[model samples]
Target: MDGTVVTDRTAETVGADGTAGRDALNAAAAASAAEGSRSEALRTLSRVFGYDTFRGEQQAVIDHVVDGGDAVVLMPTGGGKSLCYQIPALVRPGTGVVVSPLIALMQDQVDALRALGVRAGFINSTQDFEERRLVEAEFVAGELDILYLAPERLRMQGTLDLLSRGTVSVFAIDEAHCVAQWGHDFRPDYLALAVLGERWPDVPRIALTATATPATHREITERLGLPEARHFEASFDRPNIQYRIVGKDDPKKQLLRFLREEHEGDAGIVYCLSRNSVEKTAEFLERNGVPAVPYHAGLDGGTRARHQSRFLREEGLVVVATIAFGMGIDKPDVRFVAHLDLPKSVEGYYQETGRAGRDGLPSTAWMAYGLQDVVQQRKLIQSGEGDEAFRRRAASHLDAMLALCETVQCRRAQLLAYFGQEASGQKCGNCDTCLTAPETWDGTVAAQKVLSTVVRLQRERGQKFGTGQIVDILLGRKTAKVIQFDHDQLSVFGIGDDLSEAEWRGVVRQLLAQGLASVEGEYGTLVLTDASATVLGREREVLMRKEPKRPAGRPKSERTAKGERKQAVDLPEEALPVFEALRAWRADQSREQGVPAYVIFHDATLREIALSLPADLTQLAQLPGLGEKKLANYGEAVLKVLADHGRLEAGTALEDDSSSSGAESPSGD
Candidate 1:
């Protein structure tokens, strides 16, 4: 019974009173065993990881898995998805085998677990032969509580045979959404994971992901052969993140300004669409005094790993990257996630933005969306390598994203609805639309004018044009392209003189979003859809969100002056120095230990420590996130810091102006 689940066959035996007495006895024994196991799990959680109670659906999910039940858990980032399996693995017998997608982050994951005094190890291609041998020996000897392996490793016979020699308590499939064939981040190797259940029917399995739509959820269940597994769907809403999308205007400059004004010196990620864009944006931010690094598949693996390591270990560093950057990132203090380009789909957008505010503090999800983004995305989908059905699915995803961008309603509401969840209210008061509602006006004439220009280019000129040329022809601009094509002679020319270039682009973009227009070919030439006829015939009235006269500024409620972003956190003035001192101490510990700072102590834990000003180890143990092991390891050091800070406060004012700087933002690691 060494943590291994053993089924009781006593119910199969019949007594003199038939099977009733035996069945009742079996039921009582099973119930008592389950209760005992749950109590052990709770103790393990507190003693190893700190945390008096489980969060959200953690206890239920863990209990079911501990009792030998398969489960599919869909929880948001920083929602403690790891504990759902971690606790059970500790409560049950043998080692927890975690199937991870990010081989590079395995070291950090295992390091974090080890810091909690849990015996954790990982075997991946990155490990040398000696390292793999040591971990394998540990697992076989039952010295390791958890063992992590890449999903691809499961296909190797050697790896499979190695697992057979050790008792596996549970199989945890992390980043489980990768099983979806058409998901935003699909890995071909994940499809092979269905073998775990086939091979070991007695061991419980749990598939966990931070992002997945209803369709992706079904795909995961079907592909992973977990139809009978209990599904635990938590709310996808991350209320701590404020969502904002502004029309692109000199996008690089716009991004620089946004960083300077809102997230100066904050730890964040800026996502671009191309490798070139990632490099250029990183350079621009560095030039403008925003410390940023570039990350994409184009970069060397070592460089990418170095940058990721720096972003994880350092504070107030931004990593400008393509979609390849964040998948299983466990950093808890990232303040914002900015998008320099529009994501191709809502799922991708949601997943990327979800990387921010993982610690549940206030953060932002900003994007510099533009008409060109819409056009470029459409062009990519049309020219992408996929079947008609794939293209249709891609188009549908894009439409949902575009709808979210253009919606006058609550952005969070629309996003939640896309994932098949309803919002609690119409206005969340945390998004750009709710903060400063945009005006939606009738654009029937504008839509008709733009559509007529497309018609004139096709019918009269017998040529197609992109948005720039179409916009020029409507504005009656005598540019070289227009004069070369003699586009000014058309009847539609000069009819749109009332609108500026930006306004015209907005009209075209909205039309495309509403399906009144379509983009075709590699050039992104405008084309009319069947829906255009009604608008041109005055039979349909188009409602469009009016573009603000300028890019919308930060909401007044959340706005702060340059280098004052830390004011958003409602900490007392006296506790600021203590928090900064703890951060400094933690930073030193991280650098000395060669692990991420958050692994030593998350910002949330430090903030609580500062607020409570724990006088001794006993008081410190009462706080959240401080398990028995962490207290024994660092509890005295924390108490010493508090004592020293108290003495300094008693003697002097402790007026450290640098403590309030932007680099010390509330969410800094």
Candidate 2:
């Protein structure tokens, strides 16, 4: 027998109208049955979620778990990872227990599930004793289809005992990368989750994460004690997100310009390295007419929560934050994610940037990188709290990120390659390098000059200097520091005057990236590496990317122009007004319900509805995402909006009301 079985008892509950109540359906689907069948799963999916079919590996994953098999799934963000466990939980008997790291988002998660008419409940620190007791009662009685618990809750004997009392259908560990002890988002509590298998040997477990490299994938399997589980790794490519990195030149100004020219009035995120930077960036954006808020660990928990809530519930609000923000964000319409500072690793960068365009709309992942970013990151790793092996691992991660930044090939290809996936083509035509290729020049002499300077300073003067002093000496600026250090007297000094200061910095940056030099100590002073000898001996040639010149009043790159146009082109001109009207309606509903707008209906769904111009509830039900509950709840309202628009198009004047769809467009497009 399969793990899940829908019994004839459930079918007997159907009324003469051929419709079962929400409770009856949820109970029949979530509780014990005679067998688990794919046909039943499809029926439940269409009836509850309104999707005709599963996407990618969703069907295979669901089948394996429904048949009492464990799984470790690595699907990209926006890749329908939730449905992998969600469908099986509903198909199988008893409540599906989800161990999630996102305690802050449990309410919203449960709310979304409930909106689908699935009986979902949660137990977390946020709930009062009475509220938790009620949920516990629901679970014990098998009245809940799904039960969400934070990973930390599992460590409690009470939580374990409560689970033993209930008939658990399956166990899902979300954000499973948290078990990777060395991962960017490691949660120490996740190490305790392996006990789930020990406690409930028969219950199938599924571990899911949005981002994980091969090593992290193995680590999650080992840590979760799912070594024999079926592993499903989906392509990590988020093709909707266009990746672009620019050489940092007055990065704040560059960011402001990017926002103004391309993504004005759009919701996005700006990441900085420090809390102070986060605050200042948010303030700067606000002052410059961009509605922005700061979020970081420095802020109180309430402030952080409030800002996060605002970012979610309100449209076109940018959240400036440190790395603390964006792990498990479910907002689907973020237009961009800008990094003012370099991220630490390809994995971290990929995960952070993946937050954008979760709705599968055209979005951007932009970053401003420079020589200082490389230096600062190296210095942090050197002085960071870790042993030698940890520092080496950190350095390896940084090296991969730097390589992505310095690559002349397609950015998307390099990113995919880092995760052990191959791109379909050499050029994705969506990234900066593919759209506007940068020029590569031989910088062998430049590399030699920089290395020689380091050698002269260390050997002759027994001293070292940071990148600035080195550039000053190379350009022969003869600044006060140069005069004080008597650096101008060295033979290697002034030899690099042929290149501009910016160009020399590029050389130094590339040299460090190429392992020709290293940053040492607190001052970030440059020192020659073993590879420097090969370059100095003329045995190796250095190929460096020339920084593209951006003069004043320059035109925006074709990539940015195309991204802007792509968003506009998604909706036909005739259907745009209808889409806007539907969006306005959605915003009002979300505000009333205290949930994010997408939780009601995604912009994609609205766009389809507008294009199709569904005339009635029957027609609306034919559209994707209009699940049974959503159709019943909002179908009449949607049809009414279409009817009003139709009348308005025919020039039939209607009475204006406060809830009129004539209000300004809520999406800010």
Candidate 3:
């Protein structure tokens, strides 16, 4: 949700908030009934879906859709959004048509749904015409409860004709934010789905998006022809995902160090901006003792799918990929996500980082960014074909992302603030900035000089020029660009010599971020927006964080003394004693099984079995980390230890029943 829509589009608020309006009265009545109906719904939800309780606005949104109404749902990444619509589709009378963006996701989702005994099917580009016909027949006869289609297919003539004959219950658009061009992923095909109302007016519609800014929410409702949709906004807080952004310098080394120190044998993904980078990084990591695989658009479909399957099924394997990967992937145990390069916008940044900690365990979001990333992003946007209006909005978004990179404030606070949410924390103490304090300097005069230079340039040149050019003019360096442009004669010239070029760049980046300046893609110019004039007119104060010197060694621990992010062996302290005893017994059992010590019992399941201290096999399966295979194989031995010891606590020990003399094993065992 760390995104916004700052475009020329008009946003309309549909229903009145007062007491007596028809829409409001209807919405209130629906809300009242939802509280009472949850119990009945729960019986059906559990019997059909195997889920007991709703997660984060799921029930409210589902109720809104179920009772013949329109709604726009904004939920976080792992907030169980699919269930909000899926449950209602199951309860509805006719087939529910879901418009999604990805074909692979549709297949996986439908497979999972069918596994639950729901009548689900999908039509996408991957299917042949005959295959498509079979699916269409099933959908037309109401044999399929939920039908998934891409936005493009939803608008196709053949598909529309088929839908016209079938009894459509509701229309749900997944990833609804793609309807707006201002959003990160703007698909032209998505804009065509707005005519669903014109095609079928009576069907209740639901627009679902994982991350939407205020503007995006407005755009989605307006474009999708849902002017009177009820709104359900889930909180954007993901407390489990620890966020950290490091300044660019030896990024590869920092990544290696972080991986070695924290994620020695955990599953994770390292994202890069290019295919070559992905392959190179993956190979380097493998050489350094971590088993890793590279995935990108450059690989053939078969190879890519095979590698992805391996990564998902195996533990402790890292996948280095480009933006092409990790979309809608349901692998929940990804321990960390590392970005080798900075993203173009905060929305893109948030979406990428949100992939970590999906299982609600402790995880890290690490990024390495620099000024070069800013320049490249500006060049890309400038080169894109669009009106000046589009360029300005894109530039503003990029500046906001850059500001996030350079801020001394809490990283989480700045991130949440961009999406118009107030993060109630003075210090997150998880990010690099929060872990180590930065040097702050009063750059009021320097800020004024930079603004004055922009004004002297008549605000014509775009904001893409580096602070070096402006600082040169201010310090009277007489650089060629400044001399040719006659910027050296300005009164602001020679006023910023107290600041170095790197320091000045930081200020310019912050100014752009605060909306004081705008970056122009054409002619690679930098201009000031209306926000900049206010700063120059003394209405806003300018504060900047000086770039901290790269620490000679590792910075002090960002976590607290208790190891806030310390990756322990996933064992409870109360059962550690039993774990030690089992590990020793397993070490001796390895000789009998003719296998390695870990082959007999992994540290992960041993920890779980020990924590449960299961006196019987039935109770052992209920423990946190034990699986069917583990429970079947190690059930008896693990239960024997707990029964013999009768739940030994962390520091206590039990007599060695396996040893004839009943002696305790040494600490190493």
Judged by lDDT relative to the true structure, which candidate is superior, 1 or 3?
1
Model 1 lDDT on a 0 to 1 scale = 0.90
Q: Could you tell me which residue pairs clash in candidate 1?
A: 3-93, 50-627
lDDT of 2 by residue, 378-487 (tens): 99998989899999999999999999999999999999898889999999988888877789999999998888888889999999889999889988888999999899
Per-residue lDDT tens digits of candidate 1, residues 587-611? 9999999999999898889989999
Q: Model 3 over residues 483-550: C-alpha lDDT tens digits?
A: 88776776777887877776677677666666566566544456777877667788777777776555
Model 2, residue 536: distance off in Å is 0.5
Better of 2 and 3 by TM-score: 2
Residue pairs in candidate 3 whose N, alpha carbon or C atoms collide under 3 angstroms: 462-525, 462-526, 462-527, 463-525, 463-526, 463-527, 464-525, 474-494, 475-494
1 or 3, greater by TM-score: 1
For candidate 2, the per-residue lDDT at 248 reads 86
Which residue ranges in model 3 land beyond 4 Å of their true spot? 1-37, 425-437, 444-542, 551-555, 558-655, 658-669
Which structure among the candidates has the greatest lDDT? Answer: 1
RMSD each, Å: 6.2, 8.5, 10.9
